[model samples]
Structures are given as C-alpha cells and as structure tokens.
Target: MNVLHLDTSALGTYSISRQLTAAIVGQLQRDGVASSVSYRDLAAEPLPHWLPNPDPASDNALRDEAVLQQFVDADIVVLGAPMYNFTITTQLKSWLDRVLVAGRTFRYGPNGPEGLAGGKRVIIASSRGGKYSGGPAAAMDFQEPYLRTVLGFIGITDIEFVRAEGVAMGDEAKQAALQAAHATIGELALRKAA
Candidate 1:
C-alpha cells in the first residue's frame, strides 16, 4: 500500500507537526502493510500557487495530475501542517489547489457533491501556536476545517487528525503539546494493529 506523507511546516527542524507525522508513518510501517510513503515538503519545495506554463514544479506539475495521482494511487495519506496566524500555510494551500480537480476526483452529482475516490484514509498532523483546540478560538481555526473540506471534496472523506496546539505559548506549553502528540501517535499505532 502507498502512503503519501505531505509535510507543510515552515520551520524545518523545529516543527512539532513534522515530528508527529514521522512517528505516525513509522507506526504505519511497523504494521507490515507493504507500505510505501511519498513525502511532500511544501516550504522546501512549494507547490505553485499559480502555474508557470502548467509546469509541475518539483515534480508536482503545479496541477492536479501528479498530486491527485499521489492520493488516487495511495491507500493512505498523512498531512503534516502547522498553523500560521490561525490558518494553514500558503504552500499547503497551493498543493490543495493542484489536487482538487473538478472532474477527476469529484463530480456534479444529482444530489449536489460526492466523493469519487473512496477507501483511502487521511491523517492530518496539525500544530498551532496557541491553545485553540475546542477553545473559543477553535472556530477561528481554518487549517483543519479547510483541509477537511478540500480533501473531502476530492473523494477522501475518511480522515483522522492529530493536532499539537499551544506550542508558542512557552516551553511548558510546547512540551505539553509534544506529549499529547506522542500519546495520539501511540493510539494510532495501536489502531494500526487492529
């Protein structure tokens, strides 16, 4: 099975989300599902927000073909994202723009909208600087909600999220968030066994 790991952390080495995603991927690999992972780092190799001659930059094509193909071709997808000012990174958004094709991944159904590509699971590893999960600021979190909509639109409805919030408050908050992230990863690891 193919697992696509998309990491969008602006801070390369200091991103808690990226660390959690790595843990998740490692756990998935231990399950012995014949898994293969595709890594996409948006900051280092950003997806084109607007294509320059429809070129697929960094092998992404700045279009849906390669990006959607990654999901359409994979059994699972793991997104590592960091909240920037209450929203996700622009680089990740660019990647989404490439994958949410109108006809290929979705269609104009009689009901309204329906996901075409089913059976794949997506796990989002998100990090926020402040205490926002289920808080009054939670509604302001456009990262997770927006990702849910965009990925859901293109036939990927089954999703699980591992969020690390309150990282920027202080060292204590960051440590707490990291601990929570690890706990979530362990649970996912157990789930993989089941």
Candidate 2:
C-alpha cells in the first residue's frame, strides 16, 4: 500500500497527533501490508503554499501538476493535525491548498462538478485540548468536518477519524482519550482498513 502521511502539528515529536499517527501506521505495518511512505512534516519541511512563480510568464499550472500527481498515486492518506483556535492548524490548510488544485483533484464538467481521484482512503489523527466529541460543540469542530468536505470533493469519500481529545484537561482525561483513540485504531486502522 502506498501511504501518504501529512503530519502538520507544529509540536513535532511531542505532538499527540503525531504519536497516534505513528501508532496507526505501525499497526498497519504489523498487520503485514508492505506500505510505502510519503511523509510531509510541516514543521520540518513544510509544503509550499503554491504561489505563482516570480517570472511573469511562469505558469502555476506546471508546478502544481507535479504535486497533484503524487496525490493521484497514493492508496491511503494519513493526516496528523492539532486543533488551533477551535479549528485546524495553518500548516494543514497550507498543504491542502497545494494539493486540491482545480482540474487535478476535481474539475467542472459540462453536466456538473466532477472529481478525479478515486479508490483511496483517508485517515485523520487529531488532538484537541478540550472536549468537542459530542453535543452542540461537536458541530463547531472545523477540523474533521472541513477535512471531510475538501477530501470528499476530490472523490475521497472513505474516511476514518481517530481523535485524542481532552488531553490537556489532566492525566486522567489524557489517558482515557488516548486509550479510546488506541481502541479505535485497533478496530479500524488496520493494514487493509475498511
């Protein structure tokens, strides 16, 4: 399986989202699938926001075409995110802005809008400071829902979310959330994830 992992949490090694993504990736490998990794560590080597090149005649299309090709070939995609200001971090959004190019991930047909990529699954590992798992606040969660909408616009409809929330509350809350995330990983984040 070709796995494209986009780890955007600025906390880097200390990030809970990164840890969960690692554990999930480890689980997949342990389950015996030969996985190829494409890692994008936003803090280390961030994906460019994809502004037009300096030369007036230089086309953005050529530059973005190369990156979109990478998206088309991956079988599974993993995104590691940390909540910021009740939403996703800027790093994650920056990467999305690069890959979700028009005519690459999606295009407008004569009939209607059409997506190009297919047959790939997306896994999002998120870490939040407080509780937004359920209730009215859940609807306010901009991270997962935004990701779902954008990726789905490119025809990536199969998505699974594993969150480690309330980690900042205390040791007890952190442990409980981590355990729950791990359990979800065990149940769903397998080699051949369904």
Candidate 3:
C-alpha cells in the first residue's frame, strides 16, 4: 500500500504532531501495511496558497498537480496538523488547497455536490497547546472539525485522529498527553493494518 505522510509543523523536532505522525508512519512500515511511503513537510517546503485570482497556467499549477497526484495515489494519508490560533496551521491549509480540486477530488452533480476521491483512509496527528476537546474551548476548536468537513467533502469518510492536547499546560500534562496519543497510535495503526 502507498502511504502519504505530510508534516506541517514549524516546530520541527519539538512538534508533538510531528512526533506522533512519525511514530504512526513507522508503525505502518513495520506492520507491512505500507509498501511505499512519500513524505512532505509543508512548513519546510510550503505550497503557494491559491489566491482568488490565480493564473491558471502558472508554475504553481505544476506543483499543485504533483501534490494532487500524491493524494490520489496514496491508499493511506497521514498528516501532522498542529493547532495554531485554535485552528489548523496555514501550511496545512495551503496543502489542502492544492488537493481539493474541482472534478478531481469533488464535483458538482446535477442534484448537488459529489465527491470522487473516496475509499482512502486518513489519519491525523493533532497537537494542541490547551484542552479544546471539551469545556468552553470546544466551541472554538476549528482544527479537527474543519478537517473533517473538508475531507468528507472529498468523500473520505474513514478518518482517525491521534490527539495530544494540553501540552502547554506543563511538562507533566505534555507527557501524559503524548503518552496517551502514543497508546492510541499503537491501537489505531494496528487496527488499520488489519
């Protein structure tokens, strides 16, 4: 199977999302679920955000096509999505803009919208500085919700998330969150392989 791994954290080695995504990818490789893997670090090499008025034949189209091809070829997609300002990072958004193409990932049918890119599994490693899963902050969480909406729009319904929240609370909280995420990855990655 082909796996596409995308890292969008600017924190590099200090990024919890990156750490979790790495472990998940490693687990997939070790379990023999991923025969080939393609890695892309959005923060390190970001794609240009498509503006409202973009040149159709611009050089960015080539790059966008390549990114779209990667998404189309992968059976599994792993993303490192670190929360920034209670939402997803700009780097990840840019990558999403590249992949969500008309008539490719989705299309407008006579009745309504129809998604073309179905049957692919998506796993996200999400990291947040504070607790956003519940309480008042839950309403402010645009990270996972937005991702789910966009991915589902493209007909990708099989999605899983490994989350590490409350990392900025303290070292103890960070460790606990990381540990929990790791345990989740262990179970999820194995289950996915099966």
Candidate 4:
C-alpha cells in the first residue's frame, strides 16, 4: 500500500502526535502493510497559505497540483495532527486546501456536493494538551470533528484516530495517554494484519 505520512507539529521531538505517527507508520512498515511511504513534514516545510487564484504556471500552483495528486495516489494517509487553540495547525489546513479542489476531489452534483475521491483510509494521530474527548470540554473540541467533516466531504469514511489527550496535564497523565495510544496502535496493526 502507498502510505502518505504527514507531520504538522512544530514541537519537533517534543511532539506527542509526532511520536504516535512515527510509531504507527513504523508498525505498518514492520507488519508489511505499507509497500511504500511518502513522508512530509509540514511544520518544517510548510506550504504557502492558500490563495483564491494564482497563475496556472506558477511554481506554487504546480506544487499544489502535485500535492493533490499525491493525495489521490495514496491508498492510506497518516496525519500527525496536534490541536492548537482547539483546532488544527495552519500547515495542515494549507495542505487540505490544495486537496479539496473542485472537480478533482469533489464536485457539485444535481443533488448536492459529490466526492470524486474515495476508498482510501485515513489514520490521524491526534494530540491535545488537555482532555477534550468528554466532559464539558468536549463542546470546545473543533479539531477531530473538523477533520472528520472535511475528510468525509471528500468521501473518506474510513477514518481512525489514535488520540493522546491530556498530555500537558502532568507527567503521569502524559505517560498514561501515550501508553493507551500505543496500545491502540498495536491493536490497529493486528487488525490490519488480519
């Protein structure tokens, strides 16, 4: 399988989402599920903010098309998405803008909007500073829900999130979250292998 692995964390080695994504991709590689992997560190080399229109032959336009093509060619996509201010990073959003193009990934149909791209799996390594999965903070969580909405809009219904929440709560909480996420990754690999 072709795996597109994207990391959008500015924290580098200190990012929990980055660690989870690396471990998840590594597991996929070791389990022989991934035939090839394409890695893009968006934090390190971020795409320019999306514009309404650009010259067709411009370098940025060409790069955007390439990014969209990569997404189309991949069988699976792995995203290291850390919640910033209760949402995704700017870098990840920029990448999304390129792929969610009209007549490419989706189009307006007689009924409504229809997705042209389908049948791909998306795995998100979601990290948050505090617990947002439940309790009062759940309403404030715009990260995972936003991701689900946009990806689903493009017809990707097969999505999974290996979440490491409450990482900044304390050392113990961070460790526990990581342990749980790792356990989930193991289970994911086993399921894929099956």
Candidate 3 global Cα RMSD:
1.6
Q: What does candidate 2's lDDT look like per residue over 1-194, in tens digits?
A: 88887788888667999999888778777775536877767778766676755574456655556456677778988779888888888888877787776787889999787767767988889899898978878977888788888888888898999989999999999999999999889987443555
Q: Relative to the true structure, how large is the alpha-carbon lDDT of every model?
A: 0.81, 0.80, 0.92, 0.94
Task: Kindly report the root-mean-square deviation of model 1 from the true structure over all alpha carbons.
Answer: 2.6
List per-candidate RMSD values in Å. Answer: 2.6, 2.6, 1.6, 0.8
Off by over 4 Å in 4: none
TM-scores, in order shown? 0.90, 0.88, 0.95, 0.98
Q: Which scores greater on lDDT, model 3 or model 4? A: 4
| lDDT ranking from best candidate downward | 4, 3, 1, 2
List, residue by residue over 53-170, the lDDT tens digit for candidate 3. 3665777766788889999999999999999998999999998988888989999999788889999999999999999986998998999999999999999999999999999999
Judged by whole-model lDDT over C-alpha atoms, candidate 1 comes out at 0.81
- CA shift of 194, model 1, Å: 2.0
Question: Which residue pairs in model 2 clash with each other?
Answer: none
Model 2: what TM-score? 0.88
Kindly list the per-residue Cα lDDT of model 1 for residues 78-134, writing each as its tens digit: 889888877888888887776666677778899987777778888889899887777
TM-score of 1: 0.90
